[model samples]
Target: MIDQANKLREMIRKKAETEKKTKHQIKVYSIVSGKGGVGKTNFSVNLAIKFQQMGKRVLILDADIGMSNANILMGIETPRTLLDLLKDDLILKDIIAKGPYKVDLISGGADLFYLEKLDDKKQHEILSNLAELDEYDILIIDNGAGISKQSLTFTILADEIILVTTPEPTALTDAYRVLKAVSTYELKNKIKVVINQVPDMDTGDYAYNKLFKTSEQFLKIDLEKLGYIFSDIRVNKAIMEQLPITIINPNALASTNISQIAEAILGDKEYNYNVSNLKQFKNKLIRLFG
Candidate 1:
């Protein structure tokens, strides 16, 4: 009887450990672009909404410096931003504003640029605050266009990166530049490309292949084509109306394309997420700053 009881206890403990390892983990994806006006923020916001519709808790961190426009697209006002946390002694919970479909938004803006200059104490405070966001299933970081220290830091630390680009020649060259910078860091995070504003599937493929082949040949970096967004006029209308295309017209070609990308992301089973991802990411950022 004693032996049987001990055996049962051991089995239960092992089962609990196994379940813990198999549980879903929060994912962090940084949406970045090499040039402005590539619809990076638009894609980030809509992707967040799609993830929310699919029953995932999503948060969009508008880390676009002075270009923190995700709130504008979400039709919400950011009364407080990440700056408030450092300057006003506010907590992360206090600055997080709710957007459409209950998505969380944090306007980091230029405030994130100051993070690297913070002392260890302030960094710890910010880290503690970020810990409260563990309930979120996904974090979409909308980085500023072009390369910057802040953007590259987030890109390197992110679990995955979505590089948005257009079919323009300038856009493709700039996109390749961003990949080159990432290659210099020797980070192995998965980088996915999203060709936005494409007139057709061939245009999208051409854009992806340009970046794909260039990065593969020059930087030896493998790229995945997440998907593309068509040039839908409804996208413009939705932007002017302060709503995401997905919310205003889910049937729009652009909206459907974003939904497909979201589906593909969730369907990918190879992502290994650790519960300590946020903490690890924070530590890595701090080290980079150091």
Candidate 2:
């Protein structure tokens, strides 16, 4: 698998060298759930670490509205948040918090003013600054669960959405509900599923098939599989310690699954999420939230 990955990466490199210098593709993925307590943020944080390991400049935008905590999960301290940008006119570069593995983090900071009263001029200022900081290769939005307006907005605008759920009955039911909600947004192909906390590959396959078959039969949408994370004690331990499990215990079952998932995503390059500039990407988000 390592050799295959190396050859694939080499092919990508040669292809890139021969092609003209177009803008770097910045992929945005919204990791969401039907309800809370399903390990969505944990997956996002570890996934960021995996992407960083793969040599991609990864950023975690804890845009989960009232429940944002990518910094907390990574044991990071950012002196600033989105509020700093709105209130004190802080640049996007200034408010960004650095997390483990040097993954850049941006707090949602969705205070009343940020949620409802941020003026267009200030929005443009922050976005323009963000456009200048486009060194990142991927931005993952750890969005809040369910059909909240903010969550839906983030998922809809993202280049792709990864809907997470466990194998429990209630969780699977809610996962389906979230998928139904995302269907309203009409980015069917961009939606993927991640079955978390499975006991084994059989359980994972069953969970994924349950949802996949349901979505196909009822919603008529073909959801792709991003892969699954097994139930691992190291996951809970790392969460309590506020560290990425992959960093703390790479040999853990969940970490191994996440690593493979990240590699699979990197190897699939059929989609290009190029933002002409960072300001342009900001405009897309602003349109969703403004």
| Top TM-score model | 1
What is the Cα root-mean-square deviation between model 2 and the actual structure?
9.4
Error of 1 at 159 (Å): 0.4
Using lDDT as the measure, the top candidate is: 1
Q: Candidate 2 residues 1-290, lDDT tens each?
A: 99999999999998875342234557888888988888999999999999998899988888777667778889988667766766664676778887758798987756512644667786666655654545788889888877787777776567778888999989999999888877766755446788899888888899899999888877856688989888998889898998889999999989999999898888777545333344456667567656
lDDT of 1 at 137: 81
Reference-based TM-score of each model = 0.87, 0.86
Over 4 Å off, model 2? 1-22, 87-89, 112-116, 271-280
**Candidate 1 worst ten-residue window by lDDT:** 270-279
Model 2, position 45, has a per-residue lDDT of 91
How many residue pairs clash per model? 1, 2
lDDT of 1 by residue, 1-290 (tens): 99999999999999986555435366888898999999999999999999999999999899888878999999999988765776666877889998858899988877777766789887767766765565688888899999887788887657888899999999999988888888878765458889999999888888888787878777857799988888999999999999889998999999999999999998887554322355565566566654
Candidate 1, residue 245: how far the Cα is off, in Å: 0.6
